[model samples]
Target: MEYPGGTREGGLPRVLSDPARLAALEASGMIGSAPEQVFDDLTRLAVSVTGAAISAITFVGETRTYWKSVPHLPYTGVENWQNGVGESFCYFAVGADGPFIVEDAAKDPRTAGHQAIGPWGVGAWAGFPIVTTDGHAIGTMCVIDAGPRQWKPQELETLAVLARAVGNEINLRISLSTAQRALSTAQSALAVSQDLARSLQDSLLPPVLRPVPGLDAAARYLPATGDVEVVGDFYDLFHTRGPWWTALMGDVCGKGTEAAKVTALARYTLRADAGDHLSPAEVLDRLNTAMLAQRAPRYLTAVQATFRATPAGAAGRLCLAGHPPALIRRAGGRVQQAGVPGSLLGIMPTIRLTDVRFRLAPGDLLFLYTDGACEARADPHSPLPHRPIFDEEALAQALADTHGLDAAATNTHIAEVLAGHHGGWASDDTALLSLRVPPNP
Candidate 1:
């Protein structure tokens, strides 16, 4: 192939036009193919993971880059989705047969003079090559930012992992095409997909609560048994600003990757807005607007509390968006509900959110949870004709029993209680967060 600027070293990288690589890509049947939901989900997950403006799966052919999925880009026709190979950053990953990263496209020497930098609005770019099982690099899975920023190591690693997942999906398709090996390969693919789902699901939630000065905080996420797909429950504890922090718990409707998209958006949006807005209601209200603007695929209910440590204990504002009211366990074991009920988010243009002020004196604790706690039901195989549900009253009693326990102990006790109620087989995803002010020392 001839280049307008003359061949730098026999034109573009040979891998972009490798005969064997092209054969593998053709065998995969992804080029110029109709959009697949799984590919789209991966793109969405890319955006969610990196908080990037755009994410895409592109096949770098001899002369054109064929887009298999671009979650944020407006879709046209298949012809419109393809562009000259020179018009994409994907070829960089394909050429390297590995990850291609540029923190600042316009300033990075490797891409400063690149033509795609201007048209594609490339600033910071990171991508990993999607390689076939037979060791042919076919394309790339990438994330794009409109402005320059450094990519984190973990973020790049995740892109690499997900790129492998894309490769696996493509190879799985090829394997299933063989009549004799279909059943055996299909079973293996299911196991790989389930394992990937679990990894991605864990990435969506915080592994450990960030320490809050003068307070003890703890959280847990319990996935339902017998379900391999990801669920929507999530929780977080982070500093909104100096001395002020936000604790949140939410449940998006439905399950699978669709719900994960919303869960990630809610969590990042809340963190982004909480620092600027002290009112829990104001921050949550802004999150609602962001969700609606993004056309979030699922609706979610959440409770947010923004508070700061005080000499007496902690003081904060709390709000609920169609979520179960938070339970407060007093120093002496009295349990009470907090927050005014309001509308859920992502479905309405106008929402009702009220910030109710509350204080956590020394030895008090605020417990936030998803409906899974209050609505937990007995095991499906229970012999009783009518199974018992661990309702709000029972939950309150459970919280009251943990009055003197610290945050970590409180979370553990509640999880145990819920597990016992459901016979170790919860039917819904559950998230629990607790913030406790230690007793005076």
Candidate 2:
């Protein structure tokens, strides 16, 4: 119920030199294990919201610890959150009743000697030890920050809440796993699940962006948080019948594979039908007609824009339907949204949209994105959600700032800025596409 500060007992103190820490953990534990899918999902959920580099579940078995899901780390993909006796922070992460945290692991004597903390420069950690409803130290739902930090109490509480939920999920996973084993003990199923998610995601995106005549095209698409495979947002570039290189970016308001499907539909439909419509406005109109035939009733938004990179440089037309407008940087020192973006694709009846015409003479840059690029938070419980939004002025500043970066460089810079502002992943799937007119020959 509580949202991040204060100790459970005011005077318990931060020192682990007390017998109470032992007594508290020795009491009845918290959850049970269930199936692999649910276990994998919760492990991902823990790392995501916490803005940590790693999130995983560790089962402290008689021999050693095993990871249910290890999402990210300071190293390569061939590892999990495994540790030996008294080696992992979880060994000392036990709490008698609820959850506990190590805001700065290097500062804590008991865990400072641990490998996951000492040599790795790991300084901040929030751990919620999960126990079977009875008395088993099943695992912990925790976040690991590479550097030291002053963590608020509410953050630990949220981790505890998620850890408890993880308990339920563990039990669910164990149950599901039992049934899964009954049918087949193929551990490969997990790999398959991961594969399908990856395929669905990759297939939805435009893997290769064809080269335009004069402008350098660049883009980046990031997946959603945690283990979920498919992202609800998509972006792509299509070489039409003429010199025009049509590009589209959009987001499905919801989550999961279903949204991914819708996003793919939007990306391609804009390509296949935009040629028939010719202008950005007509393209969106036709898009709405295509989307209205689908099932989801809410915010199905998209931005359809076309760029023609010629010998002298590039020019384009952009139309918006309930999506954020394009960020445009002029040759001089000015920046602005490319045009007046309209409503989302399906929110209203059939209406004519206005197309914003633009010409990128030699150094002009254009950027299009979903809200996820701008809206994300680091310390989720801050007084105000610390997510970043590129309001007109800020967008202009970003564009102006990118005067020296090439198309790809500028695109990367924007991504780094967004990630730095709100941690990572932008709370949702992020799709970004940029076009920069090269210097006149």
Candidate 3:
């Protein structure tokens, strides 16, 4: 075949003037891009195979020859290995039909006066064209030595194979970049959806707890640890009417959207029925009825308490619905569990909860909590297959230890202890409500 740009005397190669080849090189989208590590690795491999002082993957562009990778080259305070198109040996290699080798650039007529010989100190050189799938040569994979050396035929073949491998790496990198961008776009969309779900879940619970006269009350609701998913644990303390105030805490079965729905339904029903002046047990029964009507595939355990002022102090009635027992800490540091037994709600049509009536003297504390507190592991970091449970016995001991602490301090202390026991992350959701009757004024 005839050459696009005719060869010079002694068959010295020149840049091709074929527009089709130039267009293919321009369409590759690799020119003037940031250097890639994959190309750097290929160049290093070429250096190892040829035992040369310098190895580079070069792209021959219209105006300049760019070194995509030159692993062993020292920094010269310049941008990169870039030179005028005709000044580098890669220019001739890109135009050659096959591998091009010059045993000594100083004596070879083809490269004797080349600019690469004087300042670059290139004595011996070997290069192979990096051809594209469409039969267009875009660049070269090259090795250079500072001293004259003859390249064996097998060495020439190895360089040819390395050149093809470099081509494959470039294509792989482009495909990988495209995939990473697509993954980033999908992750952004998922984050937006999770934020919306969290907001909606927050709206379903009480915004803030109101203070009740003559009582120091504090409550906490902790979601399950780790990923941000909607949990079913909730607590609220609000006044019904007149001198009566009601407080409720519950945990629904399951997680995510379905459990969240049941949690919202149960909270609204309890608040709506509080104004009827019903007993603590009656209110929970009403909640059970409403839950059964919805027929949601979830169940929950709950504790409800109604407080009213008495001559000696505040008196209250506690009702349990398949939930953990409430604890009563006397002014004298005696801890007693309410120990009311009942069945879970939402599962049975006619559910009944036991009501345990008790009076709180000045300096007395009433503590209500969910099963998460009892089932917590004693040593979360233990390597043993099973860890000890932080059951009611341990909890009662903790309460007894905090004898004279007020409502807020007591709750904070309990929370800290629970966090310590669980390695600062609760495996399940936790809810705690503390009600303290102040001393007589």
Candidate 4:
């Protein structure tokens, strides 16, 4: 092939003039976006299937090959991984029609003098071009091995399949972005409200939970269907003073910025009060006082539980304010509800709150959730006059059936059940927290 502008002599691959390919890639709007877990997951799967030490999703630009995802490489201070167009195996793969495999770079004419061979120590490689819906090959899904090895036929097939899936995902993202842009112009006020709600909700919720001694904990927050604006459900698990830990789950009365303000106040106030070694009921009382002082047009329903290590296992004091009762699942598969009924917060100056104290034995589980879980409709799209709610009894039964599962597993199972009951769409936000007492030796 007679190269134009550049040739192999200068260690630069011939630059092909494919304007459509470059335009398609630019239109996808994915060149410099933040790395997403979905792409990293694909790269990880590629590494596992190909038995390669490193895997990456690479986009071949005009003068550089940008790595969309490199699972094993640390970001350090670098924002994105990029290499010269002539230096990467993906550069050649992007021009190829199908899977490109070099079993031994040192012995292969096409890759022996490649720039990546020396510094990156790439001895073997397999890459499949990621083709767009319009038939433009813009990038590649590739696997790299440090030592010489033979590429298996099955591995090549798997890489090709993953590449197609990546291409589809890129197309879907592009289409969704285009639609959102069009919608934003039409519904500017709604878009702004949604953005504000999402930002506020995210800021108020705990990003990560700190591990507590002798307890296994997990939590999840699911937004409602068509939830452009954020709902009021939130949960948190945090450590308190010596040997004390607290878990909170709550729901504010409304949606949007007003509800978000109340949510923030409730979470922070509870944390502040609990730090004084106050009981769960006392913390709620203080929070109620704070909410009333604000005089906001919103009410709050919540459950606050303080736990401490005990000789038997873990002891907890739970206080409820117009909130769903927490469920306890015993090691022997029995389920019971705990927490006293009380009036809603921020509604009245004088509120009567009750506390329920219980001890969790080894292998027992504690579950706290928002009302959305039990109130989820069994069939959201049903034409019948009435649709049954997946009530508390149903939730208790499900927990009893999943007796031996760990905290994370139990939460996942419950989410799946909720999805199934609601026909895969809930009308309201749902938050769940699960705590399990570790088995004693």
Candidate 5:
């Protein structure tokens, strides 16, 4: 089998020579590397195809003495440069820039007297230079047979065709090396971004909301979804001036730094204004004013409420902004959402806040959460929409299902239920705050 250049020289045995096959190989280029890689690959393949003990690919120019793929050559890398380029068959390949096969190099005038050839006892030598697309003889793909060889036209031609492939392969190697470095850099950047987001999200949560007396309060804030960078959802519980302690929970429209800012603003505003109003409704009204005044990145949906606790462990005045009504279960075991909703804070400044007058009797509980709870989903398409609302019925049932749950258990239940609802995925940041009103002494 023969392609365009010349026949192949046989040293070991077999049939890698065929014109149709050479065409196929030439068209189907080397991948994952630069042009120079093509030559290197050709040299290695030549060693296997020709059954030669040694093979090399040499680039002309500054790398004249360099053997690209010397399989059985001793001490061969780019640095073994104690000899002249004229002493090598690798140099002759550069002159031919194609197949240059010698059955016995010891008697060949071009290499017979070569210093390294005599010392190394090199006899049979065959090689071809790899030419670049620009027609420069950049490198050679060659094979060294220790003994003599019967030359075959098909074999030598196959070697030449393979040399062409090596040119492209060399280019591919360069490209691959460059691409690998780029990919590594991108992955590192992504990891760092994730780490920073997690740090920021954690820092957004206040270390201590302090403690509200007589109220066994505990809260958990988690990302709505897999994005560790999530922000904008939070819960706050602290002693607000006098006999009144304010507890407010809210979420922004979106997730990230913008949302985080709004959350911080809302929490601080509630704490500052909690003592200003004796009624829960008044507290929300003030918060509404605050939200409208700030020009943030986006609008927000939030629930801000103040609970006046009695020594009996019940809330005296409960004011709520636009948000889910509270779920209350008395010691007697009856449960209901302290139905109160005026409007969502932040969206409107002159929002009307509703106040539910009630006492959180001893041994009662309050369930607070972001929309990720009631509307949480388990399946993206499990006979439910993405944001399924818990409504009044669902909320009551959830509380009843986990009645008298301690801080850890209650939060865990909430997380699992939310996860289950979303098909094991909370599409947004889900937050849960559960408190059990202590029994009266």
Candidate 6:
């Protein structure tokens, strides 16, 4: 069979034959793996976003293509679940090590005569490579349509993000397996486990907050001490569209892989819905629905703020579900609470979420955090029999004290205050996000 790009000669891409790439694929252990809920959730999400008839997580091997998860198609056995390497479009993504999209498979030169098109009834296809940490293309998270249709840019971008999520999941399992093996030779298995925990936790969150035009933003994540398991605290700040931006913080109910999966789903759903909805309540409502539909392993509480910079300052809506209220610092150094109390997510069929409108004048700032900040307590090892918790009143006082500080400074000061209370050993994971309007010249 002929390949698409000239990068390959007559047969498949050289990457398919590369020993290292093949080794990474084998180590993934997903070649003939049974269907799992996590992958199923992702494929379902892909279909929902792309409006496709079928969505799949496919891994291409040297001789065959394996379908790990296909929400529309049930898995019977390994022999019945795979096809020859040249029989599917998955190799196009693997060979090019990138996305392979075709609005019309029958007309596109790359896939005109593809063997799977007729049997699969694929009128259109869009796939993104699931690459490992070491840069090996393992498989793809793709959507397939029964009739020809043009895909939108946003839909494709979301697909790419989901593909990376699949890659992260695979790499996490690989890392855990390596850590388990290291237990025999390593002097301290605990240290190796902690490193693995931190890595997995980091993947669930954004490394740094993205800048929003006319708004000052800063964020920080503090992990609980002495815990080798991954926690579920996460925060993100991003632009939704022209002039609009969103900032959110959430804490899931459990730890380890279960909580991680829920966190990933929440973040992905939040991003996908935020673009279409302007109200924070609507965005989070959609998230709650998605969580329930996906059968999320853990329930979570989240606070989201969606706002756009105005000529006078910044104005937008803030919503909270089964979480603490958001704190706002006025230019006069007065700190006050915002957000209406509502239901937590993924626990019940019905929920009540309210979006409260808010505005920030020049020199004013808005702050969001997990319960860890206000619930902080002295180290358990301390001599004091009764430890005092850093309650909401104390948090408000700390925020008010940073009257003239910028967004970054405000977050730094609050983090320092929390550390002082906990003695640098937090009991629960803490996430902090702040957005401040610049003072007028």
Worst 10 residues of 2 by lDDT: 26-35
Clashes per prediction? 0, 26, 0, 0, 49, 0
lDDT of 4 by residue, 174-205 (tens): 78888898888769877777787777778878
Which model is ahead, 4 or 5, in terms of lDDT?
A: 4
- On the 0 to 100 scale, the lDDT of residue 404 in model 2 is 56
* Candidate models: Cα lDDT each: 0.89, 0.66, 0.81, 0.84, 0.64, 0.89
User: What stretches of model 3 exceed 4 Å from their correct place?
Assistant: 1-30, 33-157, 167-207, 222-225, 379-387, 423-425
Candidate with the larger lDDT of 1 and 3: 1
Per-residue accuracy of model 2 over 191-232 as CA lDDT, tens digit each:
787888788888888688878777788988866557656667
lDDT of 5 by residue, 141-208 (tens): 77777777865777677788787777776556545765787899988987998898777777767665
| Of candidates 6 and 3, the better by lDDT | 6
User: Residue 28 CA error for candidate 6 (Å)?
Assistant: 38
Give lDDT: candidate 6, residue 375: 96
Among all candidates shown, the one with the greatest TM-score? 5
Deviation in Å, model 1, residue 2 alpha carbon = 55
For model 4, which pairs clash?
none
Each prediction's RMSD over C-alphas, in Å, is 24.4, 22.4, 7.4, 19.7, 9.5, 26.2
lDDT of 1 at 355: 91
Give the runs in model 5 whose Cα sits over 4 Å from its true position.
1-55, 59-65, 71-138, 142-161, 167-180, 278-289, 381-392, 420-423
* TM-score of every candidate relative to the true structure: 0.59, 0.55, 0.68, 0.57, 0.69, 0.58
